[model samples]
Target: MKSLTFLLVFVPLLSVCRSQSETGVDEELGDEEHVELFTTATTKLAAATSDFGYNLYRALASQDASSNVLLAPLSVSTVLTQLSMGASETAERQLYRALRYHTLQDPQLHNTLRDLLTSTGTTGKGLSTAARVYLSRRLRVKPEFLRLVEQQFGTAPKQLMGGAKDLKDINDWVSQGTGGKVQRFLTKPFPRNTGVNTVSAAHFKGKWENGFSQSNSLESFQIDGGTTVRVPMMHQDNYPVKMGVDSDLSCTIAQIQMQDSVSIFVFLPNDVSANLTTLEESLTAEFVQDLSMTLLPAEVSLMLPVLSFSSTNELQPLLADLGLSDWLTSPGLEKITAQPVKLGTVNHKVVMEMVAEGNRYASSTSPPSHLALRVDKPFLFLVRDESSGALLLVGRMVNPKNLRI
Candidate 1:
């Protein structure tokens, strides 16, 4: 089965993260063409966000209500920061928006989100707690909403080739895209949804524009769970990295060139393996602003799932935790456009499914393959585009149950 997915790399841009009393802060002083490219990428990314928002809506619509499944959103920048301690909100959003563009590029995958949602029972929250109210009716319109997503994505879908290795490509792109907040999503068995088709891309890669020493990999390392993993940790010396609003937040990034529009980015929170939700919620544009204003370097130690993997999730409540107020059950899907009639409620809905396997592969009894690490907890993550900070696909693995794919 051909991998039906998208891919790209991410780069941070000069955008005002927070207003400063300083004079030159608001102005973006970068190569006009490069900035333009990032701008176009952002446009594609915003569209991708719309697509993922809708796709997630479908995923929520299909979930079994009894599971009490939920999802959470983290600013793309925060996770990248935690991973390697480097990146920006605009850059992270570009990563997310890219995922959206990737989805828009493929009609089969885009439409598939609807099919899987259409088959499930509706029971749960919407993108927002309020959105969940629309489940009954919205669930009925998944096919329609999905159609809307395809139409919204526009003629670009025609440009995508069905035979492309979508998941891997997308993952590679995202790795390069975010400088690597997301290293790899699924590489082994391509993640089986068991019930429907699902595709996910996760990646993080970089060589320290200055190249970290491989000798550092020999150091004894600290794993969040209290056990020490003698990791082959790579170290970058005296790297020019950024600091977040608080001294607690910091980041470092590695640029990956080639194959796909992607990069390898890492964020290092004050505490490695800190509670991600708290970390995400704690993120503020102002803090990011502070981060962009300063740069310094300290010895860095990194430990992550060195491989890719996948799972399943009921992401509604999880979304509620993040701040997506009304896309799901909020009377209607969240309004995409506002003509200023002061729209009350846009008819909205949500549904979810794990996109994995093909007609040929689904029927086979293949052994479950393995990657380097298992996603067992919540961590800020994304698979995004290089040109735009838009998230092609967004997720938080608060729990591995969501990794069933």
Candidate 2:
């Protein structure tokens, strides 16, 4: 049997705030009503995909609780769902179940995804996503499947000749997709007996709505073993932000806006010695949606670390652990080609950097007020698209100095 490979890359952007008001109009109506129906479908699809991303992140974090973790769950779920279109009935069922899409009653999954891609890829938002499929040179793809993938996912299958040039082509394609932010995504050679491969990338470079001052100071960061390290921390006073405390999770949540309809929600545990396991496990699409609505607006002295890091992770083992072992072992993707193919490996890479670069400020050396919220310890953050309610990235920052995964 031949092996299929999946590659995903995500660069940092931000996240969204969701509204639950539903329109109760009938679907069978005029053009305006059709637009409303499409909007509703895409909204529901975004929520479903976000839930899948949260589940995948929890599974990945469970593997190594101490290490820094970063991933673009939306990109991963998008590529996998795109691949599922070519899967056989049994294989499709397993894939949908793993992705948490089996419970959705909507039949236009592909159409909804197309709408989502269009909505989130708006210009000037500093956010973009793309997907492509590559096939072994020997196998011939079905024309109908090619048309469907091209029309929905915006790319057709290409031939992989299994050489170094093929690797360069893949990397170049990824670089172009992410506007050169993510270059050389695949550093290693493709495995033997590779059959089909899918590549997806998302990139976003965002600025804060209320910019932080360029003048930053080194602050003490508390890590494990009763030790502390000084790191450059961006500071701003009297910043308008949504702040709240989740008693159930025992953490302080802060939502900061960016240029576009994007927000970054920071979850800082009340105790520096607290473990983020409980907070991480408690994240779901519905949970985050409700939590965003309840946060009260407040102005506080804010300090955030200058974070820039990237990680490359092999997700095959994680997916297998998440109850998709059979699908990976025998992914009947017959629609792509007549040849037998199984999922061999899944590779995911993420690059994120949040900096202070919106407005200039005069230098000031003053003590932080009592209402200051300094992110000086381990914390979790979610970058989302507020317009579509899509999760752009989910990350855990433990040791900023150590960027390796």
TM-score of each: 0.36, 0.85
Tens digit of lDDT per residue, candidate 1, span 303-386? 333212333333324343233333222312222211111112111111223211112212213332221111222233433333
Candidate 2 regions off by >4 Å? Answer: 1-39, 359-369, 402-405
Q: What is the C-alpha RMSD of each candidate to the true structure, in Å?
A: 17.6, 9.8
Best by lDDT: 2
Which digits, one per residue and each the tens of the lDDT, describe model 2 over residues 1-405? Answer: 011111111123222222222232233443332122114666778887888888889988988878888888777887888788889999899998888788777888888787877777676456666566667777777888878877787777676877798889988888787778776788865676777666666666667787886435788888866788888788888777787666557788988887778888999987878889998987877667655666767667899988767777777678776679888888899988888876655667676767786545444455443466889998999887787788888888887764432
Error of 1 at 177 (Å): 18
TM-score between model 1 and native:
0.36
Please list all clashing residue pairs in model 2, or write none if there are none.
14-383, 14-384, 15-263, 15-383, 15-384, 15-385, 16-384, 16-385, 16-386
Give the least accurate 10-residue stretch of model 2, judged by summed lDDT. Answer: 1-10
Best candidate according to TM-score: 2
- Which ten contiguous residues of candidate 1 have the minimum total lDDT? 125-134
